[model samples]
Target: MGNLKLFIGVLVAIFIIIFLLLIFLVYKNSNMKKNISFLYTKNIELFKANNELTKDKADLNRQLNGNDDVFSELRLALELDSVVNSLNESGDGRKIGMDKKLEGKFVKSIPNGVPLNFKGITDNYGIRIHPISKVEKFHQGIDLRASVGTPLYATANGVVEYSGMTSSGYGYLVIISHNFGFETRYAHMQNKQVVRAGEFIKKGDLIGYSGNTGYSTGPHLHYEVRFLSRTLDPINFMKFNNIFYDERKVPWQALVKAIDDF
Candidate 1:
């Protein structure tokens, strides 16, 4: 009887040890699975954050490109303005100081568009012998000679200030104030039609016809560009992308296409 009791006690002890070992293995496996799950969740969050960062980088690049394009256009406009201003004042021996106050204001006002309808240049801006007076004088504008009835158009959007003859050598002058310190004048017109003072004129809108007037010796149009009362050369302004004559319209498109291709 004593031996059987001892054997039964040993058997009970072995079974308890086995059961405890099984329970420990089960707990360890469950803990390992929980750790793996946490690692997977962490990895997923990191991936999502990385994707968002990539998208933000792309968007920032696009904005930077857009800003660059705007800056390029602004720089071109400023350069053209400076060249025209210098040419108009050249040979006069009078140095006109840079108009800092008018720079920002004028640049914001002139919109991009073609200014005139006639092609070819008869005269450039500088000191030249006056065709009519035969005296050395400063030419403040450029001459565009066309047919007597060729339509003269506004270069930019503005309100007309004067549309009549002036003794200052402008036969039939049309002055348009574009505000922001920029104004334009069309002189030596054969006739004035479809425009008047205080009338709102857009770029390419007909203001008059080109002709010999205002001390001109031949059939030509005198076009003057001004900024803050200072006369600027019309030639430099004509080099801008917005300025064009009838034949120049197609050439402008071709130039733009070439630039795009490049």
Candidate 2:
């Protein structure tokens, strides 16, 4: 035989080079299993974009800590409405001095310095119109204006109960009688330094100057206040009375002579 057909054609070319090296190792293991399933679907979309960037950085740190607690409760309700409109340091701004701590607690019915002198009041009781019989009536009291003599005082600890001409026409009165039932008066005055009827007076003393005399209207300083017999409303009791015996100089109009009242 021709050398046994050339060793069976060199074992059929070594079994066709082992079937083309097993079809190039099964096409490089199907392109390395499609590059390991596209690197596990891009690492599950980069772990859902790093878990949605850690839930958008914890929703932007809870909206910046709820806007820093609503800007610290709107800066503590504008510093407690600037200490309740600084009641009466005679407004015009600056001097609202309030220690704060309010949600309602702001009581001070009366008694806290009490000196209430004058700062212009020129009439303000009620149903006005009568500047001098211009018509409508009922203006019980509160004229204040002050100029002639001006002293007046007393406002609190009292007893006088009658001082001069005021038989009702109050032309130079005084009254007083305080201690709960609280009577006050003061009227026109001007005949000068006079404070008699039972006398006890203490809250600032003086108790007499300021003239124009009852029922009229011009010089001014009527100021009345009754309370059990009723009358009340000396300009809403000096716009919420704390009177200020003297808090280092209050009087911007001190709260409200209706300095517009509250």
Instruction: Report every candidate's CA lDDT.
Output: 0.70, 0.62
Cα lDDT over the full model 2: 0.62
- What lDDT tens digits, residue by residue, belong to model 1 across residues 1-262? 9999999999999999999999999999999999999999999999999999999888767655555654444454445445323433436665444433333333334533335566778888889988878899999888887878788778777899999878888888889997455688888887655688999977778888887778878888888887678876676566653443312212333333332333
Cα displacement (Å) at residue 249, model 1: 28
Worst 10 residues of 1 by lDDT: 244-253
User: Residue 131 CA error for candidate 1 (Å)?
Assistant: 0.8
Q: How accurate is candidate 1 locally (lDDT)?
A: 0.70
Which stretches of model 1 miss by more than 4 angstroms?
1-108, 111-114, 241-262
Q: How far is candidate 1 from the true structure (C-alpha RMSD, Å)?
A: 20.3
